[model samples]
Target: MPLDVESLRSHFPSLASGIAHFDGPGGTQTPRVVGQAIADTLTGPLSIRGSSVASERNADQAVLSFRSAMADFLNADPSGIVYGRSATQLTYDFAKHLSTGWGPDDEVVVTRLDHDCNVRPWVQAAERRG
Candidate 1:
């Protein structure tokens, strides 16, 4: 089936405001349902993930549900689903982990078109490995 671009775009309320957001650390525009879910979770009765208390159970369920949904979307195992505070942090962490197996013979190439956050992590990782 053909993609419904307009229908997908309609879900993001920020797109209607006619402002382009470019801040990498800020975050991308989220859909209305996603925004609502985030707001609800932030304002909801939440505690440490557990089953002893209602708040804890709710928080635990929310995390499990998110992991399940993301796993389904990515066609990956839910056990492997990882969440990071930011893309930059995740990239750095992943680069560090991946570069452990690199040798002096290996080459790490980054393009100028990429953002600094994307480029710096791999460069630093390669330098560390070398």
Candidate 2:
């Protein structure tokens, strides 16, 4: 279906306030279901289980759920997926892995318009490896 602006707006409690939030580059908001899912994950009974078989199952299910969601979102293989706090953090982690075995003569190029998060980690890694 086409973008349901009103339906999507109903999900975000933050949008209910009269305040405006245009701090980021993108002027967008997440659906209420997304926020509710995060809240449920953090505060739900699934997290309070002791180290028992049931708890282990719950934890495994949570991981599988996350992996499946991520794979679907990115159209990527779940096995190749690695989760990070943000794209910057993820890029840094990938840079560390990909930069291994680089020689002193190696050079790296980073974009000017990219976030500092994306550039800083690769620069630091190149310096260390050099």
Candidate 3:
């Protein structure tokens, strides 16, 4: 069966603008439902993560739901899902963790096609470890 292009396009509010976005590095235009979901989460009952109180429990539930959803999307374990504020931050954190045992013979290779955000952190981590 052929994909329903019109049906899929309907969910993206940006489609009305007559521009087909193919941006990368940062994500492309998101669907209206996804944006609305983010707005709803931010507007809902929220607090620091914990289980001792109602607000905290609410926060904990949100975290759990996030991990579960991401795990399902990525086909990975929920416990392994680590959320960061940005892609750059996530890359930096991962590089720091991975570079701990690096020595003289070790090298980190970053491609020219990579975004600066992806390249800079790994370079810094390699320098620190070297």
Highest lDDT scorer: 1
Q: After superposition on all CA atoms, what RMSD does each candidate show versus the true structure?
A: 3.3, 4.2, 2.5
In model 3, the runs with Cα more than 4 Å from the true position are 15-27, 52-54
Model 2's number of clashes is 1
Better of 1 and 2 by TM-score: 1
Residue lDDT tens for model 1, 3-27: 9988988987888888756644435
TM-score of each: 0.74, 0.66, 0.78
The 10 consecutive residues of candidate 3 with the worst lDDT sum are 21-30
Task: Kindly report which residue pairs in candidate 1 clash with one another.
Answer: none
Q: How do all the candidates rank in terms of lDDT, highest first? A: 1, 3, 2
How many Å off is the CA of 59 in candidate 2? 2.5
lDDT of each: 0.86, 0.73, 0.84
- In terms of TM-score, which candidate is strongest? 3
Which sections of candidate 1 miss by over 4 Å? 1-8, 19-26, 113-116
What is candidate 3's lDDT per residue for 53-130, written digit by digit as tens?
A: 877887788788988999999999999987667888998888899899899789888897777888999999989987
Model 1, CA-based lDDT: 0.86
Candidate 2 residue spans exceeding 4 A from truth: 1-29, 46-54
Using TM-score as the measure, name the better of candidate 2 and candidate 3. 3
lDDT of 3 at 112: 79
